[model samples]
Target chain A: MRIFVHTTYNHRDYLKRLYAKIVDVLKDSGVMVITNHDHEGKEDLTKSEIERMSDAGENVLDKMDGIIIEASVQDSEVGYLLAYAIAQKKPILYLYEKHSGAKSVMGYFTNSKIPDSVKIQVYEEPDLPAILSDFLHRIETGESKDLPTIKFTLRITPQIERFLKLKAKQYRTTKADYLRDKVIKKYMEGDEK
Target chain B: MAKSRSKIALLFFGGSGIQTGDGRIFEVTKKEEITAWLKELPELGILADIEPVFVFGGPASEVTPALWSALAKKIGELYPSVDGVVVTHGIDTIVYTGAMLSFMLHNLGKPVVLTTSPLAKEMQSPADSEGLVSDYRNLGVRANLINALQVATMNLGEVVIMHGNRVMRANQTIKSIGPGQNFFEPIGEGLLGKVDFGIKLFGHVRERGKGKLKVDAALDDHVCTMRIQPASHAEQIARMIASGCRALMLRSYSTLPYPQSFIPYLRLAQEKGIPVVCHNLFALKSTRANEEYILINDMTYEAALTKCMWVLGKTREREEFRKLLYRDVAGERIKANV
Candidate 1:
């Protein structure tokens, strides 16, 4: 699974160490991780990489299976990204440091309607690895309760129906699942008006 | 009770300006797609009635002198119909374009603001990765465009660059390096205004309604620039003049005397009826202005270079070139010390 890790800029040394630890735990689990922090003395992204990322927009988040944000700092930017990630329907693990003194702006979400894919947890530094491990396990197993579904029928050409049936059979899946995974999911993630 | 929004003519040059919904840089292929992208930022609609004119789609480095002339002409055409104009450009060459426009568009009215969303790599800092992430995604571009749109409706009248939180005169601006919040800095007292709680125009800024708009877009791009150094040879200067270099802008050492080796080439350039403009002359030292070379101080390198191109396009006659070069056009030169 692929994941993205983000955090605020407050409490520099502590957060940097936390980022390094989180990256280590994710890498140890054989999961691909993209992070905003420069934990390993890597040079910042090149001009071409920045252009590619800017052009990609929320599609970058769409490619990630989940997101992990350290919200111990009160940052409006983190809040904005959190909203975008939720809109992308990516499973999010919002981790706040226990007794960090500074309240996270993520607390504002508590009064609002929160989605099932979001899990907010306050933890001591020692609990991070375990929390991340459990979250990854749940993500891999699809343990989150499925969101409510609505049924709709669409009329399609016979050629399209035949193509869907053939694709589903070749992929060893039902036609509905094939449409949901391949067609609808992609359409919903892209170019939404 | 609501105020009427300003009608802004937005000339889109496509350099990190718009990111489409489907993860692609806007190429201006479809007009409808441009409208759709604009809808994503509704605050722009609230700020002004933007009439987007697609100029071109490419990196700003590809921009040429001819393109600058074309853009100036386009803005001239749109000048009468819109309250103001904003050009979206690439940060790489936005200052050059701004300086060129400041000279090309002879105006005494409405703000002609040039701005861009700088590349993320240019502003990234490993020490501030969290802030960089937010800036890279949307805050940087969004804030710049919104500010540019507002500045377009201001009382200022001149070509200016609105970047970060500073409004700088185009001719006096210089590109800055490192991971600072601002990518450009003014050469002298080049800052015309700023954006804080609200936009504040400095008293020295040219106000609207001084005169009618005029387009003097003629530019001769044959001028070359060279920085003088200890190991520099006169042959290098000779070769430039031999290769049909119309004008030469030599950057002199700030503290050191003008190199004795290049004196012969200065005489050679004068003998060939070519104007050699020297910039960055020592301000404290008295450098006598001779017929061999013209001395320039208190002007940006960009202004000196583009002014050479503009003057060359107008007149190459020995006295006429010097007169126009020393002329304070668009406030490029503070005081013609020569």
Candidate 2:
């Protein structure tokens, strides 16, 4: 399978490692890679060159089966490229590095803050094989289910829980039943889809 | 044999004559002196013999000892039988005073109308009194019709007589380009109606001196209202959730792109046990649970304000709030009825 790789900012070193992993994952798997920068002079390409290449349509996304984006570094070229892919309605496998402190590109993708259309995976180390295998499996098997759906993760006080229960009772049903009905009714309305 | 007519009390506090973003305080002259321009009302056959009480002060003045007594006398003059009150004030703290008055005058038979302008008096000559005539004329008319417990506030040309409880701001969401006008457009929401005191039709007027005002200032800055926007990040909602906010009003977009970002934050609100009231938007497919939250002012404008006001006054409890939030106000609870 042919895949296009997009990198950002000055994270070329990170991309080289990520690219090598991509090759290792798809060995003998018929995948081709494309980028707008010089292979050896990855150090020489300035921010303008990267931006210019982005503006120049390379026709790579149409030819490739899917897009692989590197979003580990903060405020880099790779993140903008990934955002462009998401906006273009292309299937994107977004990869990023997880950091506990400060805002990370990966956190932005994972937080229930972004649209659900964009799929994201965070890794501590470049484990392309595992990431690629899973992504390809999703494409080949059409089993896009259980792909880590986003959920609101705030703690509820006991007072609030009791309030919900009392409210559910007032609406003439158990809390579980009320929740089930609301979820089903909302989904059937086709608002999120 | 009635000793006097329904008394009209006009109170203008904190009126400003200059221009600035905060110059909404400059509206006292417009709202306070409106009774002097009752040419249209007499033609409409209203306010024919109504008593008129007028008072004015700077924007910083609320209900002061001297001011309150002066206003009280004005009410008595309008009608030794002064049955209602019409107050004109700066927009900034109008709702606070409105809520305070609503709490104090529970089940009041007489209507208390609050009105203001968005422009400064000096921006244009006598500019402060520009819309006063229309607003004052309407208050007398509205009070005469709906006699129910009334608490109202007006901006620009639009007026809303919200129940005492329904007086919360859009946090930093409210934006106004012109003076005295609402900072933000209703965002597909609109005005229900203005307060009037000209007629005596609805039977909302209560027995004289019957109700007590309750001032609950516990809200402080803990309660906030925000509009959900497209692409809004989860961190924004999460921060609010973690901050220990007791209540939040989520002004959802009208069927327009319906900010999908709210889906997750709303869930967070549910998980955190914070009460989230959804207004001005449609339901999403993957939206959290229904019983977990409350929805209001769905499509109609008037219904939402009336319902929001009534609900806000009834309970600070999440469950009770949700119940009241979903219930109909002005009979516009469900879409089918609208």
User: Which candidate comes out best when scored by DockQ?
Assistant: 1
**I-RMSD for candidate 2:** 30.8
Candidate 1, residue B159: lDDT: 90
Q: Which stretches of candidate 2 lie over 4 Å from their true place?
A: A1-193, B1-6, B14-81, B91-105, B118-221, B255-262, B281-292, B298-317, B327-338
- What are the models' TM-scores? 0.60, 0.36
lDDT of 1 by residue, B99-197 (tens): 889888886498999988643223333243333332343334566676777788878898999876678899988987734457788766588876432
Rate residue A114 of model 2 by lDDT.
45
Could you say which candidate leads in lDDT? Answer: 1
A1-193: candidate 1 lDDT, tens digit per residue: 8777876665578866887788889989998787755563123335465344433221334446788888777443355456555434458898878876654444334224456678888888899889999889878866655532556798999999999999876543468766876567556856564
Error of 2 at A68 (Å): 84
Native contacts kept, each candidate: 0.00, 0.00
* Deviating ranges (above 4 Å) for candidate 1: A1-193, B18-33, B120-134, B137-139, B281-287, B335-338
Task: Assess each model's interface with DockQ, reporting 2 decimals per model.
Answer: 0.02, 0.00
